[model samples]
Target: MSLDKGGKNMGRMKISVAAVFMCTFIISAVPASAGTSGRSVETTLQSDLAGSLNPEGLLLTVGGYRRWISGMNEEYGIPSSYVQSGAMLGVSPAYSHVSAHVEWKPVILAQVRLQYTLFRYFGDFGALLSFPSKDSPFGKDEVDAREGQEEKDWGQRYLLQPTLTAKAGPIIIRNQSDAAYFTYNGAGPYFLEWEYDTLVKDGGWVVSNRTFLLWEAWKGPGKAALLAGTVYEITRSFSADLTRRRIGAVAVWTPAEGDGLFQKPRIYSQVGVNLEDRNRDGEVYFIIGAGFDHDL
Candidate 1:
């Protein structure tokens, strides 16, 4: 994470937020465990690609994702299923959850922006933005405000994402550093680490190879669990190895994943490079997936 390098207090905010949301979910979800005490595992794979002919002009992009989550209700000894379409909407330009943004484009490839998002499930809202920096990679930078539910945190949160991107012929390279902070009742300067994505694209073949790095800080809900043993172990173990870094690639065959069920889906795959508490790690966590992309 970029921490305080950008003057954004994001790193401090994420910590406090994590504590709050972890407790909230445990309190709310655990009680329903009656007749549901079991264990669960979930995994998801998705793909997306977008480009601007001008690179510095208005951008159009679309992508699709599919996720499968299943867990056991430790108390009731039953299984549970979870799926999120919000992940799809977040990256969708037309249907983005962003309520509004105040923006500035100082140069063709540089922009400054203030963005806000509302999470219906958590009843939380976020205020975020991005700024054009002289030292930025490709001259791009972003800052954001997220609510408790945005990242499953406790309450209000702030984030700073400093990004650098380079273009070499048909390949594009990008690196981003992310940090966040969380505050509740004006009580914290607590810091928490977060997520990032690295991508390498080949314009010539309309293909891309990418990786996603994500993690969770252990604190507030570290000890809370709905199940006594295995279920709790599953959650704790997963959370402890909270750092999730995935590497994958995709190849676009036609134009998109298809218009309907009769059409073909886009192909994508990913392997977990570093997994927490794993003896047979790296590449052991692999997923093959299909999705769609459209220009809007």
Candidate 2:
């Protein structure tokens, strides 16, 4: 996901204030998590929102997410899920505007995700686009604070996401990896490097991997099912030399077959802890959300 660029004084102040208010209210009103990126949490939620498999054709999803981490002041909440809609033709394309509020940080990211199946019921290749520096929201002080003393303005960002899935009896295993590239609004130009251990002077890359192991806990008579799973996530930022790791347990509930207003509904909850992190003070986190999709 991508955030919009920074604006002038008033605009920046307004966004900052709104973000603080939302974070405060959410903390008092709900639980919290550590310094996990809003995009990461949204990715997990979206995965669960798919229920058993990815939906086809036009689809819409609505839900809210909340997380809290122990040991730090950071907390994130989406009291209401942002605009999430997508469609799958031969190539699936989707868009989302995610508004995340933290104690001292507020970010709004707009992203388009395109995916094409590489093989039937196995794997796929995907790309994430946040284009036009003016429209994309990365490296903005109002949205994300600098991790170091140096100041820089980030421009467009892109990511290549590849996925793999396997199933055996009642268990399913899935893995998704992301390699991200960034552009900056400065003089220094950086070339793409496969070496994630090396730092770049200007733009850089972030790599992440997420894996899930799910078990079919229960099944209803119709199209309803309950799944329990464990998720492992690791993210590394080459520019900032930041690394985050988390492990959690999740449960998802899918409703029975129906053509009602809810369509294909999914309710999910997760609770996890940071196994290793140097960014945020928190250690544990919790998430609960519900969403439904409709085919066009």
- What TM-score does each of the candidates earn? 0.29, 0.47
Q: How many residue pairs clash in each candidate?
A: 35, 11
lDDT of 2 by residue, 1-296 (tens): 11223211111111111111111121121212234233422222212222110001121233233332222223323222232322221111222222231221122211122221111110111111122232222222322242222222323445555445555656756666667665544333332111221123345777877777888677664336677888887877676556768788877676664575555556666667777654232466555545554432
Candidate 1: residue 39 lDDT (0-100): 29
Whole-model lDDT, candidate 2?
0.38
lDDT of 1: 0.25
Per-residue lDDT of model 1, residues 80-169, tens digit only: 343323132232111122222233323222222233332212221221211122122211122223323122222232333233333333
lDDT of model 2 at position 88? 21
